[model samples]
Target: MGKKINKSSQNGYHHNNHFSNPRSKTKSTIVGGKYIYHGEVTVEELAGALNISSADILKYLLLNKGFYNINSTLDDEIIGEICLNYGFDFEKEDIVEADDFEHYKIEDKAEDLIERAPVVTIMGHVDHGKTTLIDTIRNSNIAAKEAGAITQEIGAYQKTINGKKITFIDTPGHEAFSAMRQRGAQVTDIVVLVVAADDGIMPQTVEAINHAKAANVPIIVAINKIDKPGANIDKVMSSLSKYDLLPEEWGGDTIVKPISAKQNIGVDELLENVLLVAEMRELKANPKRPASGTVIEASLDKKVGSKATLLIQNGTLHVGDYLVIGTCYCKVRRMTNEFNKPVNAATPSTPVSVTGIDGIPQAGDQFYCFHSEKEARAIALKRAQKLVNKQAKNEGVSILNLHDKLESGEITILNLIVKADTNGSLEAACSQLKKLQVDTVQLKIIHSAIGDVNEGDVILASASQAIIVAFNVHENSLALAKAKELNVEIRNYDIIYNMTEEITEAMKGHLKPTFIDVTYGHAEVLQLFKASKVGIICGSRVTDGTIKRTSKVKVYRKNNVIFEGNLASLKRGKDDVMSVKEGFECGIVIDGFNHDGDIEIGDIIESWGQEVEKK
Candidate 1:
């Protein structure tokens, strides 16, 4: 009996030892910004290297530092501070510049992180129930609570499908979604396309596919609105064929799931398909290291009292650990699940809300832990210090980009996302923007879509701070309210060429005034040609505003404006006049206005001169 008890004690000691020496692998740079390394370098020597006292170094080995009379578990802030004082930069990429950087504080190198959740973005044409489908799914599967825009911003929530986690980034703007997909964040795993069965594939649908293809991500088609009376899965599948997304039944790689999100039908099947793709992709995450990923979403936790709900991606975390989140540091006192249950630990692919910190951090904030609380504080101070220095550096570095004739100290080039009605109309609208440009500020076109704007596009535009243009498509009502709240501009246009030409002019900062010389001219009708279907040719005089063959004009009669378009093929009898003087008479034929207007010899025509606004 004495021998058996002794043997059991020995076995228990060995079991504890296994956990004590889990692995002598390289210490990872985790939260709190201290790049931890696996080496037995003496603390006094490290303190000298880190430019700190031995006591400060000693504090790095305590669990709660001097606060809780606890043994040997060190503070993360102390470790963070040591890294910071040693000239380590945690905010930037991990590079130990011996000459440039004296100390090395490293955050978890995201490159070393394993892929866990496959990022899935939902996209499709206007009113194709893209948002509706997303909302319905969020409501039903996620428990129909306040699911207002589950993807409120680029940062959104995550869902599990058969244990495979998938994060849904609410890239609010369609065009912006396209932009992000284009930037090629190697993190994307799959794109779930939502196409209304009744509406079939539209322009944005194809663009989304193209953008996904641009990013080289696989796609899963969700045939939404199957509950509708006219829901045509066959038509949706056939239309997708135009973009090469043939259904599985049709021998294509794209998996098409006909779902009625409104009716909660096929939701399970969708979840199953998502998991199937994840498994096929062989997605896995290392649950041994501290969590690290791009800040998908974060906000101050007012209601929760304290501690941020960090979505762990790489490591297991426990209560009472210190976290270095963004530039802030806080010791975790307790971890709570989504249901507010106190949990001792959270592993990779888990998002456990925690408390013990003084305040909540912002969403999308990167979080990590340190060896001790002391390290966490030190890291936070250093992060703040580095930020100040960076601000100073940018101010010095950016002044070089300016040139003479620039009015402002810094050139604020406004980028835009222009959405319009149809292909032909878009062509004409974009061709004539020769009026608005300037040298100090240039207009940049980031992206454009052809439908009502969405939240995904809005978020991207917000991130880049770009304005939006909606030619015929209006803003989504919900999106409009959000836009108004956010003060995002949504410019609408009905005329195709006018919208295009104006944006072209806008890009050049030419709106202040035309730098080139130009004049306006008017003309009156004398006789008509092709007086019926094709249009009418008016023999008229340029009365006011100097007119040229390619000048822009607006046709009007009886005080009602007929058309605001460019002068198409103006001629003086059989000769094409390059410039029609104020009094010169010319023969002009209007395109598409076949009906006879009241343009008699006494009638008038108005023209506006244009000059290129160089931005």
Candidate 2:
């Protein structure tokens, strides 16, 4: 039943008929021939008021207003559009109230605003000169210290250029650190997207662009590696245009500067452009108020206890300040700057690492200082209780009921970690999985790499509530045990078609039994023994579980699988054996692998079997 308005009155409506009210029982007032709904309203509730099916509302929104679920709250513009089609008008009533934690929002006057250093984030694909560019600017050899020359964590530093300071955030360009890069973008005032001139565009580069755009920050494109062979600045510029990042010289607003980070060519010009953009943004903050900032990174130090690197967005953070971050409260004991120098206070846009955190605050958690330790502790306790209550009410995202969750507006993004056998397979699998995004739910590949799943992958997936998708890749023993302990799902598939098909069906809530490789045990190659009949037999030690003679085995050298075949023979001390348990030495011979140098010492041999599980 539709609510009827008073046709006799041109300005308002009179409540009439007992069946007119919607299921929510919220009374609506008609003004200017439009219904005024109070507070938040869902699509189903609005549909019920309009005497229309919720499916119809969802279809209308999908076609005209983009993707939205049935329970999604309607914004003002969307509600107005829907009201137009339903032969009526609608308006939303705003309700505002102040709570105990309202001190977080400081309304500073125009006179209080002062210029602060612009926080810049360097982002690009792996080995694309992101770190090198920062190294050149800071005159430090930070990149050389990283493992494999790839940054593993977020690094914050400050550089002075022409008497003006600029804060820089060096985010890992690797695909596995997408979440870290996203956090960097959120706190940055400007994003310097580094694209290698020799290598036009890569997958991670596109991801960086998306992250910068999502943060609603301006981008300055730096065409790096210009001194290298095959440097094509024009090609890189053309590729940037495809992502809507047109160069200023090409009649666009985005500023593009060509620079060779290693040679320091055009580095000065790049810095000038960054400062010019910062000037145009006119970034300002009131440093007189209490400190409010975001945690860039946090960790537990064995010697120092809990430490967190925080970026002061506004006001000043001083040593011995009481702060509440997330559910944790901290009394700042010591403060250190980017160069590890001790500091008494840090102003706006300054990154400082502080000790005395009671608990490890997560990256991207907002922290605000309180006048006293009592206030901070009280707020932290209340937040902890609130978090516990929220967790009790909500369930973690699971692939089995993904469609149901989307329909109920519980989650709109399905996070996944993809692992493949090679670079080509990894790229292909990621590209294919990205197409599964639909009107109601989006598939987000937070991490992707070419290798077997490890314990680190399981930990990240558990923290992000993501599923692990392995394409023609094995799961190591530690990763498998961790996944089971954490209740993480690892779906393995040899065929790309089957992987996509099953995931598609699961997204629609049509889950089926999935076959996953169950690892039996892991063994290390010790010494090579020349067997007369079996050729080279590996004198090995079973490091985990149990290795059977009938099980399939994969020979791994430096974490890469080189051979896959059935076990030819299993022996223990010159005696034939059916299996060998952990901490036991055994002789293993592959059915087909017999090369002398192929099965070297220290190589890992993994035994596994396929098992089907119901989703």
Candidate 3:
């Protein structure tokens, strides 16, 4: 809405009389020409007012050189154009609130602050003993209790060493580490990079190093899995040296601890090193001031309604404190420590689960405690309204513009909406996507769910300037159309590995074609027959060009790539042939591409080869 108007009297309405009979003159006058918009309206609302289907409005907007969704706010210029096209006049109506909300800012006095514990984040490659190291130090088996036997979510814990408190933030993987950092939550004071002594370094390990270096935090290397028969501490150290993390024993400043997490070997030394790093940094915070912290994790509970794990970075959090996190606030009903032990209060750098939030705040959201409940609620509601307005003002961004935005040398944030076939698949997808971040462009998942892509997903992607990633999920016709109309990128994949690889490549700006595809021939899979020798064989006919034995092939079903590989064997009338010409019958067996039940009748197969060159 625009600024408020001060007119006291209502404007007079006028109606035109064109070919009206004498009886029509006595009827009530119709205000046909003009309309006023209080705020931005959607296509569905406009269609309802005009007594038309939403689809009709969509087509109208498309024909009028506009791209929008049913839920997208119509700009003033577009609204005016629509009115003129529909033979009507329009004006904007502005209303002002009697009480404009002011932002709440808290100032802390020097006397109220004190030294606090350092918050540490454990990061490295998956299955590199990160969780194992944490469990060994805390004397808890959390890794075995997680879904898929892997930590797919962030967890914060606290442990006391030599009468001093130390907080540890363990993320699912490096992807989640960058995800939180992109959201502006820099809660980690130190990073402990765990490298497997046997496995050496991995892709995710390199990614973790890059992220921690970008955060500019001191890194402590924990070379784990030393109990394994093939463990080589020297090899692991050599690999880490490439990342500029030479061990302290090698005359470098970085601290490296060798430990076996499963056997709890050298676990105490690791904690000692962590404390030493904290001491060097001189981490301190005022505990007597109002509490301020960052959320480590948030989820909806059937019994508790909404709950969040808050890591108090500063001040003191009491049981009855009223806290505001993002656009939500609540009076703290209770607080529990990492072990779920009830606690009356939490000081700086301690992880506590709070049970009185009205709704689930997002992970990485900054929270602050107010003096009173009324002020917390007022500020939270005002923030919620501001968020809604800001989303409306952010127009959709296309993938084409993404490169340009990154090149501008500013912080480029990529928002993603992920949809998957199952809960496990969704979790895996999110975990993998979080590890993809370049220095210039950071990837953040705005929303994730377990379902097929739908219109609601499209609307959210359009509003948030996010790309939609669907894993083993297909979209309906409406959603596809909306995505294309809004120029939103929708990437679909049946294989999880492929999805991860493609996204990682995209983040590195390597999405430009690395291999140029050269089509050799096309064929149609007429029938599928079982075989013991080659798994499954497809009866086919050469439709165009020539099918060569050395050429690679790809199966396309409904214009989607199903399988791609090299041709294993080629046959013409039961005779092994080097090539098959057009209009000839043939049978083909692809190498390492077992169709199983994916290849169906009427599916098209294209034989091609790729030419790769360094860019």
Candidate 4:
């Protein structure tokens, strides 16, 4: 047997090697805030050249520009940003030709790289039970726990199937799946398209297929709701054939599994098929090198500050190692697996949530390790300077120019401004709208807030050239006139799904869907309170069905709906209530109705919302 080296001894060997072989020094100029750089510099090289810490360069990117850490290929835009942020006037670097980047390329050694688990993404239309299926496989209640019973965020989870590991990325919708692709991260190895047996192919189902096809990934159809009374497997298969996903039974290569997420049927067979596809791909990576991977999701935690969920595609990530992610740098102080269990290191295809980062890195940002904290900080500082310069030059990039860019095919970005009546509505609307992005075409939300359409919103939309979308909110006369004068497009919706369909249509440059409102409840106004933050509080008794505080409401004056908004606050006396059953008295506040004379007692209030009948 060969002699084994202790962990400390191995680390010492690497440390000695790093100090002995010095990188070639290149002369550069820093003239009046302008820095000169050579072709295709990695984060480490850039940090070394600037005599700054790589972590500093990354911090600059995240705090100032909202960019990822340093595992970056410095582009012209980024180069400009770095120069500005570092207090440099400009960067005088030779334009890097494709072939000139040879020195930066990593030669793949077949022997060193070993096979890794395949990353699969499940996608489908709203209410198709994508999360329900995941819940069934994991034996967890994820779908039931999410707000609105809809998976609104992207999460990565791992499972063991017949002793083989598989990584699954649960994306919100087709838009989020395509958004990752648009960022140039082809992370998914396979796409599992879940379709309801009864509902067959819906608008989002088609969009999911298009996104999967665009990525050139294999798709497995999961016909869910098989146990439902209206389920028809043959009908689902027929609808799928038109999209080129021919069922295996029909002499095609596509694998179709009929499953009831609620019943947990045929899930074992689905796992076997996934493993089969994964084996064919021969997915592999090098785990001995410095860790490098993409950000799956990121958010700020009240306790931990900024936290990010990272999918390590290659190499082993260890605690205390300084990492550069999309322009921000952090030392890995803590790392946890999907189950929140502490782990010292992570290997290829592993999903880990790590803290100790300076700021929240954007999703899809690539991360890599650095040898020293000094190098990381320098690079981060230089990048921060670049961002400062870029910001000063452009002021703020608006989405309003998106239409012209799309028409010219110069850039495939859909910039939007979203307005809603409540914070929850705003969050849900943005979450669903992001799923429409595919290929080069991406959806970028310029601004999202809770309120009625105002002149400020119009101005921002005009500057950004973004389409204004209103959900459970209305454009006032001033905002409407301003929008007209600026030739800004304003779209309105009372239902969340309808707005999603409209945005998808706009992205595809197709016809918009027509919607019809259906009232579910009504109440009679008994009294009004003038002194309240919720505009005017209308004390009323539920006259029909039940009135929910979160439901959309419309004021009816003599059989015609006059004012429409949200039931901002609902209360039975001083105690807040979610709903009031028929014959129960409750006080209600309209979100946008602040005028004293706008609402009066004895007016009938109807709670209503819209739904899409069909495309």
Q: lDDT (0-100) at residue 250 of candidate 2?
A: 93
Off by over 4 Å in 4: 1-37, 40-104, 384-615
Cα TM-score per model: 0.47, 0.55, 0.52, 0.53
Candidate lDDT scores, in order, read 0.57, 0.77, 0.73, 0.74
lDDT of 2 by residue, 1-615 (tens): 112211122112111110112233463555666878764567877887777797788889868865454445675668788888888877775432111232324467677688999998898988999888998998999889889988888888999899999999887642223344322224778889998999989876876776566446799999999998999999999999988898889999999999999999999999999999999989998776667788888999999999999999887888878888867898888999988999999999999999998899887677876656766676687677555444423344556766776787766678888999999999899999988755667888877777899876776666566788999998999999977765678888988899888888878888754778999999999999887867899989999999976577899998899988777678898876667999999998886686677689999999887755533
What does the lDDT read for residue 400 in candidate 2?
71
Worst 10 residues of 1 by lDDT: 1-10
State residue 335's C-alpha deviation in candidate 3, in Å: 1.1
Model 4 error, position 38 (Å): 2.6
Estimate, for each residue in 1-615, the C-alpha lDDT of model 1 and write its tens digit. 000012122222121111111232223334453444432234544454445676655545433433211112223445455576556743323333211111333244445446667656676666565555655555644323325633334434466666666666445545555443222223456778888888887766766775566455788898888888888888888888877788899998889999887787887798788778977887766554543433333455665565565666555677767676756677778777655688887765566766666445555456665556666666565665555444323221011122221344333555566666776645444444323455546655555656678775565554445567677777787777756544455667787566655554554334444346454767776666664433667778777756655555667676567666555556766765556777777877553343566344455567665554422
How many clashes in each structure?
A: 73, 0, 4, 54
State the local distance difference test value for candidate 1: 0.57
Candidate 3, 379: how far from true, in Å?
2.0
The sequence of per-residue lDDT tens digits that candidate 3 reaches over residues 449-496 is: 777887656755654567789999988998888776655678888887
RMSD of 4: 18.9
Best by TM-score: 2
Ranking by TM-score: 2, 4, 3, 1
lDDT of 1 at 584: 78
Model 4 error, position 9 (Å): 17
Cα error, candidate 3, residue 533 (Å): 79
